[model samples]
Structure formats: structure tokens, C-alpha cells
Target: MQNRQQSEIVRDILTVCNGSGTTITNVMFHAYISHAQARGYLGELIDKGLIENDIFDSRQYRSTPKGLKYLAGLETMSELLAIETRRIAKSGANIC
Candidate 1:
């Protein structure tokens, strides 16, 4: 399996919780990260105001509007990079 970047993992987590709140376990599973990683990321995201713990259920987390914006930006960057990669391939240019 190819390793994903931290930003990609963050995006995955945000996507998972964007519509409805989800537990940390769901975030870990969906982001393909370990428990420790999930905890760390969740803490950081919460601190950054990108995610918030549900008031009714602290175990559940949901993405904030800022997080959605961040996710959108990351998705756009990924798409642009993929397009550049395809263009380079067509031109027979090495990316690395």
C-alpha cells in the first residue's frame, strides 16, 4: 500500500466527519492511521479549530467550517498535482 501524506490523512478524517460526527475509531480506520496517530491528529485538529468534539457526546467529533475549507483546498491541490503528473507523463518528462 502506498503511504499517504499527513495532509491526505487530515483530509480523510475531515471527510469522514464532515456530514455527521464520528468516533475517533472511525477516524483512525478511515484515515488508515494508528490509535496514537489518531489521538495526536485529533488533538491538533481540535486545537486548530478545524474539528470539534460533540457537546452531547464528547467521544464523537465533527469537522468545523474551517476544516471543510481546508479539506477543499487540499483536494484542489491534489487534483492539480495529479493533472501536472499526467501532463509530465505525456511530455515524457521525469517528475523526480
Candidate 2:
């Protein structure tokens, strides 16, 4: 797994792409992440063979099988955390 920031950026991009094909500009703007950071994240994902670029549309990117696996893992973790939070709430445990 990558560092938190990189993982988060990749996850955000994947989510955006899964919903609707996104341009680099939209990813940077909507995700509230820096342009450099977004570009860096994309580059890393591409290098890792986790994403592929659409040459017909230079800005278009799509997640590969590896990327999907990573996203699924992240989603699983998120769901687990949500479930744990609910359990804690039900137990009257103060999270803060």
C-alpha cells in the first residue's frame, strides 16, 4: 500500500472515474487536491499498472484490474470503519 495521501488521491480519482469519466482538471478541482499532487498521483498509478490512459483523449484515465482491487480494499476498510463506529455508538462509547 502507498502512503495515506497517495492512497487517498488514487481512491478519489477512481471513485470519480467510476461515477463518470473525469478529466484531469475535474479531478484536481473537485477533489480539492493540488494539481501537482493529482498529477503525481496519476503518474504513480500509471507506473504501477493500476491505471491506463486513453490516448484518444489525453486527459482521460481509467482504472485497471489492479486499481479496482485497490479501490475494493479501500471500500472494504471504509465499510468496516463505519460499522465499528456504529457499534461504538450503540455501546455508548465516546469516540472523542
Best by TM-score: 1
lDDT of 2 by residue, 1-96 (tens): 223445556677776655335687877865567888789877987898877787688678777778888899977876666533333455787542
C-alpha TM-score for every candidate: 0.82, 0.70
By TM-score, how accurate is candidate 1? 0.82
Worst 10 residues of 1 by lDDT: 81-90
Best by lDDT: 1
lDDT per model vs. reference = 0.85, 0.70
For model 1, the superposed segments whose C-alpha errors exceed 4 Å read 83-96
Q: State residue 55's C-alpha deviation in candidate 1, in Å.
A: 0.7
